[model samples]
Target: METGWRRVSARKSASRFRRSTSRSMEESTSSAWRVTHRLSSRDSRLRFLAADDSGSSSV
Candidate 1:
């Protein structure tokens, strides 16, 4: 029946859409994690530099 064929096609389309959306979500999460890690590292380095400068000046 035509209705049966249409139902199968709809299911296939839904699955493909789900896969694409999942991939995009994964990529976005990875990028966000990388950005956050880089920012944290930069902040730590700045703190270290500030501390070093203060220590050197005291002498």
Candidate 2:
């Protein structure tokens, strides 16, 4: 294999790999953030419900 051609091919493949990898990473990060946000909001709602329950029971 010619060294020049091999080097060019390798560089092209490496850049392609990086581009795909970064795109996937961004997608996963956004999905993860969405999941976490939903969970936190659910948790807060649960806490509020529990508090309301206790207060109602006391009254």
Candidate 3:
């Protein structure tokens, strides 16, 4: 095996691996954020409903 060719191939593979990993990370982060946002909104709505129900009951 030629040392120079091996080095070049290793570098190429490393760069390709980095690009793929970065893209996957971005996708996962976006999906996670979307899920978190959806959950938070739902929780807030439920809390609001509970508060409204209590206020009406007290009145």
Candidate 4:
């Protein structure tokens, strides 16, 4: 009977760990996406500035 209880406890612990890990993974994925989006926006702004600079230099 004690062994059965231990098994049930272990299963519950494992389920909880899986749920926490899944939540963390989702958070990480969303954060990564936000970082990439910010990086891309910065890159686009730099490209526009460079184009303007070149155009002014040519004139």
Q: Candidate 3 lDDT, tens digit per residue, 20-49?
A: 999999999999999999999999999999
Model 4: how large is the Cα RMSD against the reference?
2.5
Estimate the overall C-alpha local distance difference test score of candidate 1. Answer: 0.97
Better of 1 and 2 by lDDT: 2
The TM-score ranking, best first, is: 3, 2, 4, 1
Error of 1 at 3 (Å): 4.0
TM-score for each predicted model, relative to the true structure: 0.60, 0.72, 0.74, 0.62
- Where's the lowest-lDDT run of ten residues in candidate 1? 50-59
Candidates 1 and 2: which is better by TM-score?
A: 2
Query: Best TM-score goes to which candidate?
Result: 3
Runs in model 4 with CA error above 4 Å?
A: 1-9
Clashing pairs in 2: none
Tens digits of per-residue lDDT, candidate 4, 6-57, equal 9999999999999999999999999999999999999999999999999999
Q: What is candidate 2's local distance difference test score?
A: 0.99
Tens-digit lDDT string for candidate 2 (1-59): 69999999999999999999999999999999999999999999999999999999999
Q: How displaced is residue 9 in candidate 1, in Å? A: 1.7
**Candidate 4 has what TM-score?**
0.62
Candidate 1 lDDT tens digits, 1-59: 99999999999999999999999999999999999999999999999999999999998
Error of 3 at 27 (Å): 1.0
